[model samples]
Target: MEETEQKVGMLGSGSWATAMIKMLGDNQKKKKVLWWIRKEEDLNYVRTYKHNPTYLSAVELRIEPKNLFTDARDVIRQSDIVVLNTPSAYLKAALHGVGAEDFKGKLVVTAIKGIIPDENLIVGSYLSKVYGIPAENIVVIGGPCHAEEVSSEKLSYLTIAAKDTVKAERVASLLRNRYINTVLSTDVYGVEYGAVLKNIYALAGGICHGLGFGDNFMSVLVSNAIREMETCLTAIDPEADRDINASAYLGDLLVTAYSQFSRNRTFGHMIGKGYTVQSAQLEMNMVAEGYYASACIHNIIQQYDLELPICNMVYQILYNKQSANLEVNNLASKLS
Candidate 1:
């Protein structure tokens, strides 16, 4: 196999997972793309039709039927790289019964943007601490890039982050195509935490929008949000030398907080429109990571004894049952 054609396995079947398959193929490489789809019917569906019937229903899978599995461990066993794209909330259950030895020597990549719910650990940390994968062997994919645009072949950029530059570039090779640009970073914690915080911030943006705040107020909100993000990232990993304005950090925060494709923003908009958290989730039929992330982050802030108004306001609204109207009013006074 060519260096770029390292047999890569994917452990998801959602829009991002679908888009990843597209990236691997569109990069025009000849590597085998293995996938672990949960449902047998969906597995059969993609195997027979070359497209996922539900998610991203358009791009051809390009994966051979024989390469698809319902078992995640099977996919892990056969590939040199494993991409965990499942929602953070469900990841533990998704990888249930797969032991630490299963991850030995294989490079682990997390395309997940949320923190693991109960543990409050980002996917990279979760994998390192729980699965015992060496920090250098772990890689993370962060965006300004969304799966929706990637499926349509729109130009987008991704920052592939790891402690090891060689490992980061290795995964970047599989994702860089004519339409997708890949940048490498050693700021592993910054990239992962930035991805998580951006969702919380985006949810706040959506809530503000649904409450009738105009672009002028939004500009202020975003400017403030970035500063809050910088403060949080620095507190989390002081040793990581990173630009807060880099595509992995600021670019991700902007798109998530403003883009129509952001499910976190969509979920927050629904909350502002008077839907209960349960009801909004039922309506979206999607997981808005920030809804869960808000609670997890609130706990972290308490441990670090940090003061982040935007993140706290979101946590209060989502978890503490504070009025959205009241919270926003309080939050507005804090922002410049």
Candidate 2:
């Protein structure tokens, strides 16, 4: 690897992580994309085959074999930009031995769509508070794009957000290619919270779908969700001048809430069909961001004294042991 080339380190090997590696590789192989694969077996397989053995198996990996590392700190130590792509629930564990200084001067990008599980904080905030990384150095990836579609080389859109426009543009430039188009935003608060809230709404949509609700009600549910999202976002950050209809907010909400590839919706569908949370997780072999986000967002709602009916409904069903049928029915009457 040339020392002059930009080194980008990837911290997760899940479907989204693999898709990002694909985007970066597609944008330019000159970036020297380094990946931290958690499992040694997966690492060996990718090294040997040039494709992730488990996630996004069909998409050919554009990463160089020599850049794969099992230790996350090692990857962070070498890269100019570090991406945190692991599920938010497991993020703390993923950075096990790394210290704040390891991230001192690096640009940290978050592709995580969920809040930090027990922390009740968004990934960007968590990075700032825990690692001492400044807000300007962090970039957030927002999407209406699905990893499955990205793997298939379908055109998808991602929003790159940061407090600093220069950093956002740099990350956007790295991620954009023929299959992926990028938009840059400075509303880090709005984009991050919107991404987290969409999952809960998507899970709610899935539960409604599993309960046999027709498209008419689903449309009503979505319309109300976007309003609820706008309310919550504005309350959370009164200074952010967000449109709420941008690709980062409403567009992402629409896709996650309706897309067939949405794991959160799938998880909610299973829950509506009487599957336990543990069972649904085991069956899907994927983490539904909403399952955790439901609880986290619920906490945020209470702390902020914000009344988000859609998110409240999801929280009740998932964490309160309430009947999905009854909770959603009550919610339906409340939706305009």
Candidate 3:
């Protein structure tokens, strides 16, 4: 048996993808990683601008100009570690052409934080079922790291989760960068569940901001989000870490909840101010994962007949056409 060379490949070229490229580029053990962008136009734009100017303004991320692609299969075939950062709404469609049979012997990690609408499946769940990939083979990168902040060179932390503790450690070791730190978690489902649920809460936080509520009000919502996370996690896997109140969980909750850079938060703010979901998403020129996630999680909650107050309010605001302000106020009063 000879030493196997490790190569990294990432799918998607959004803000998160760009930031991830920079982080992976710092790996001395690995010289370069393959990044698959959706369009040649996006590849050209990043090659020239050195930043994803369309979304992340302050974070300057430039690739080697050679490590970009429009073809997904080509990149997938050549890399040993494939990191998926595509938005969840389009992830199924995105993987349509790529054959998972050829992807044997590769370590597939999910960098996406979303629950697929209607399907009500996390990216990891979808991959496991569709690709016959083991839960350990598909590590989920969860916790608090934000693409916007990473682009701006701000320090952040994240959790790498897999059923195999050793495999999770392998991802965590390769994932660390100057400003980014990653830890391994055995509770893969719990961590990913927290990551997905937090997106919905971030939208709620934005609605609170748009409704003219202060930090005090947002703090309550954030706490409520954690409670929701705990409930959802316990339903999926009891004995999951309860200390998610840490930086990775609550810390990520704060950034996505409050940051002007969060598309989900911004989308909610627009809805709170009277824009419809379609209009808000179009105006922002980005997919707010929370918008789709709120709907998806709501369906899951209803199917299980579970009570998720914050996510339910978000569903009412986006799907049921309820007033964001009124629903948030009602939710706040309930928690109060």
Candidate 4:
């Protein structure tokens, strides 16, 4: 592969995007990376405070005003590659205004994980079909990595998946650094699937806590989540990696399930504590993608007629009017 200069554009200015901006500075070459923020107020806030206080607190990042854009077409056209770090739920809507022509030549790497319920597609699948972008041009960055830990400078690793191994390597070259290690994978589907399903389990863990279940119960819930992930993903790709026991999977699940920082896990805890879905979502300031994903994935399973028992359980408790405690109790009793 030619060592060509590449300009990176970030689609959203959330915590992950800000942390990526910091990570990009470590690139050997001097590159102009643009981060798109829709709100003029957010632009001003970042400028004034020199930090993304709303999304990422304590870690201050200085962003250049010149690199911020509100115009999708302009940014997409200017960058060699675009890193889409927005929440999975907003991905399609965010790209609605931009035609395929804008993104035709650029390499797109996605850091967001969630299924589209209405479309019944993963991000890579949705982008390729909707935007006419080729699968070869789509790269998925996933693993058990968390943005909160990243902001704290904790060592983390991610898997980069693409149909073209060469392109995947290039993506690795661009992202790998002292703290972040990148592994290339041919199992794009499995990696992306695991990324989303783990969130469901993380929420389950949080719900256990919210229901006043202690560590022993939480451990069972977490273990069962990993088991569910392996079972479902292996059905899709038998050669798929089973390293979910690692930090990216189990570790991330624990943090999201238990940490005050995890909005999604916290959302589930609220629901388990008797907060209505609407109120629970409202109380959590950031996006709890699992809430939306639970609906979408549950629908996918039904449409495909695939039996995802744990995921279905989550959907029932969160949206199907099933009592959270009853669902847990029923599942626990059955396991015994």
Give, for candidate 2, the lowest lDDT window spanning 10 residues.
1-10
| lDDT (C-alpha, whole model) for all candidates | 0.91, 0.91, 0.78, 0.77
All candidates in order of TM-score, best leading: 1, 2, 3, 4
Location of the lowest summed lDDT over 10 successive residues in candidate 1: 1-10
Winner on lDDT (3 vs 4) = 3
lDDT of 2 by residue, 1-336 (tens): 563578899999999999999999888535788999999999999999998989999989887888999999999999999999999999999999999999999999999999888788899999999999998899999998899999999999999999988989888888899999989899998999999999999999999999999899999999999999998898889899799999999999999988999999899999888887888889998899998888888877888898788899888888888999999999988988
Stretches of candidate 3 above 4 Å error?
1-4, 45-66
lDDT of 1 by residue, 38-138 (tens): 99999999988999998999888677789989999999989899999988898998899899999999999999999898988899889989999999899
Evaluated at residue 216, the lDDT of candidate 1 is 92
Please give, for residues 1-336, the per-residue lDDT of candidate 3 as tens digits: 654556788898777877787787664444457878787776788778766555565556645778777888888888878998988887776677887685788889998888877678888888877787776688888757777677767887888888888888777777687888887777778777777877888888877787888888888888778888777777767876657676656777777887878777888788878888888877986778887788777767877778788999999988889977789878977784
Query: What TM-score does candidate 3 get on C-alpha atoms?
Result: 0.92
- Candidate 4 lDDT over residue span 182-269, tens digit each: 7777778877777778778778777778888898877777777777777777766687655767555565566666677777778878
Residue 327 CA error for candidate 1 (Å)?
0.5
What is candidate 4's CA lDDT for residue 9? 85
Instruction: List the candidates' TM-scores in order.
Output: 0.98, 0.97, 0.92, 0.91
